[model samples]
Target chain A: MPQIAQLAATYSSQIFWMLLTFGFVFFVIGLGMVPKVQSTVDARDKKIADDLDAAKASSAAADALEADWRAKENAARSDAQARLAAAKADAAKDREARLAAADAAIGEKLAAAEAQIEAGRGKALGEIEAVAAEAATDIVRRLAGAEVSSDAALQAVKAVI
Target chain B: MHQFTIEPMFGTDHWAIGGYNIAFTNSAMWMVLAAVVIWAFVALGMKRQLVPGRWQMAVETMTGFIDNLLSANVGPEGKKFVPYVFSLFMFILCANLLGLLPLGVIGSHAFTFTSHFTATGVLAILSFSIVLIVGFARHGFHFFSLFVPHGTPGWLLWLIPVIELVSFLVRPFSLGLRLFVAMMAGHILLEVLSSFVINSANAGPGWGLMIGVPSFLLMIGISALELLVAVIQAYVFALLTSLYINDAVNLH
Candidate 1:
């Protein structure tokens, strides 16, 4: 249509500026902000990965230390048990030696006392026999006259024994 | 038919500023009215209510329609440029639709046609720049290689520049022409058909009714066609612009 032709004819002059504006904005976005966006995403990803690695390493170290601590505790417990058994054995030996020494002393004292009582009993028996003989001789002398005293003593001794 | 032609005004009384003709023009008045209408639509669209009203629907339809269309065509990449594309589409659409409006101010005062020429020129320049800038922004100097393409024979290199230059140069021409032509055609058709109604009305009553009804119907159809054409032209203009920029910025 002629109207279209007129429209086209009218707008011919504006083409240059329009083209320029498009070119300018194109350069601004392409060369400027795109790289920044990419780098930011990259940096964030790297930081997250680093943190995860650090956490894993620390936990591994902690686990290793815990294992070591358990081993040491096991060794200490065994050593303590051995020491306690040795101490108990030494205490039993010492008690037995002390009890044996005390029993020996008691036996020696009893034996000495028993031997002394036997010797005293023997001496006292001999004296008592002698005295009985004398008394009996005296009694016979008083009852029967002088010459018959010997025979009387013998008979009195036999009766007294 | 009325005399319809475009010639630059040049005379003692004709004012010229910076080598561009300065004259009161029909295109200028139409563009002003279009601007007012668009502004009103924008204001109405932004009434900021939870529920969208009719005026807001009108604005959203244009924006959402373009958004969906681009998303469908170019995927996410098209969505990034929706605002710019929508604004550009709206401007072009308004220019096209304004031509359908009756061309008298206060029912009598006729505007100068020089203003219309400048406004269309400005729009063409704007759309051309958007394509250029958008492509370059996306691809940088790499955009320039898009014109050269890939896998061409050494002998074809000469043809490449020629084709590229012609295509690039034609960008603004197509944009400006598409809107101007559609608007101009719709207005002319409506004028002719309505003139028949006016003339036939003076004839016998049946004659008037006979022509009037058909003319009215034709006008309505043409008006609808104009609406469709207006949106199509704007889309074509922007699309070609983007395609050209894509050519300019892409690498093989």
Candidate 2:
């Protein structure tokens, strides 16, 4: 083959040019340019990680704030409930005391009215007895045409009239 | 044979150095072309954008591929050898693919430099030299232990080391010969089938219809296969080199 035949003549030239060209590739491109690309990739990765960490930190902070607000809201709600219950109890006690005082006043006024009616009835009965006695004495004296005493007529009215 | 012939571009007698014919040849031209192509490809992709465009991505992918290969094969220390392996891989890959370019349709021949033993042998020797240097530099005389597998019985120690030494020595030859033969054979097969197509058509219409058409079809199929082979050979070369470096670095 020509490859074998021409080996002694051309190998040096091939190797020489190959090394020169390949040397440029290795030194200039591989060493110089590749690191720049790799560093860019590295920087992007670091930025992404940092952004994620910041997001997580902010989310945690927000959660803590929400939890703190909820705790304060719960405390205030319980505090208002306690105050409302206390006021209701105080109002109920006051109403009961007032009702008891009003009941006592009404009982005292009704007893006084009953006592006044009882005294007036007794006085009216005594007057009616005197009028009847006088009438009896007049009748006795006119019918028999005899003298009749007023005290004796009152006694007869008290006994039978 | 004519396609494989290396014609000195500037006449053989005019470019001798130290009694060696150092005239620039077609193989040298292709090597320089491959280098230029690689340089342009890498230089154009150096935009350094955080979000790489397609061209930048393509360049990054090539370098990253070699980096990962070394990382996997030779471990962390393999990082130091990335530039060399990247250069080697790109050079061979470009040479192989460039050779297969259909430039013949435009009356210009593409020389496949990797098809020559001299070129591939030098590449193989370069990889082998690095292995030897790294082995000795890292492990001193213990690098010789590479020829001896662990847990060998005393009786088999002599025999095993001999076999291992032979295999180790054969690595460069095997590496160089594998690429050279594959590239050379594919080109030769394509050329031979092309000749058959031309010769049969000239002989008669019936022979052209029977042999020429089928040979032409087979040539097309083989040409496609050759493209795949070109890529595979470059990958295999880089892979084996890294694995050999792995042995040197890890001492196993």
Give the interface RMSD of each candidate. 9.9, 1.5
Q: List the residue pairs that clash in candidate 2.
A: none
lDDT: worst 10-residue window of model 1 chain B: B109-118
Candidate 2 lDDT, B1-252, residue by residue in tens: 888988888565368678766778888889889988988888888887877899988988887899899999999999888888888898899999999999989999999999999889888998999999999999999999998888888999979999999999999999999999999999999999999999999999999999999999999999999999999999999999999999999988
- Stretches of candidate 2 off by over 4 Å are A59-161, B10-13
lDDT of each: 0.59, 0.88
lDDT of 1 by residue, B104-216 (tens): 54474322221243445565776577667776777887676766766868999989967976877787876666555555666667779988888888787898889988998
Tell how far residue A23 is off in model 2, in angstroms.
1.7
| Tens digit of per-residue lDDT, candidate 2, span A6-104 | 777777787877677777777877687767766666676788899999999999999999999999999999999999999999999999899988888
lDDT of 1 at A2: 35
Q: What is the lDDT of residue B200 in candidate 1?
A: 88
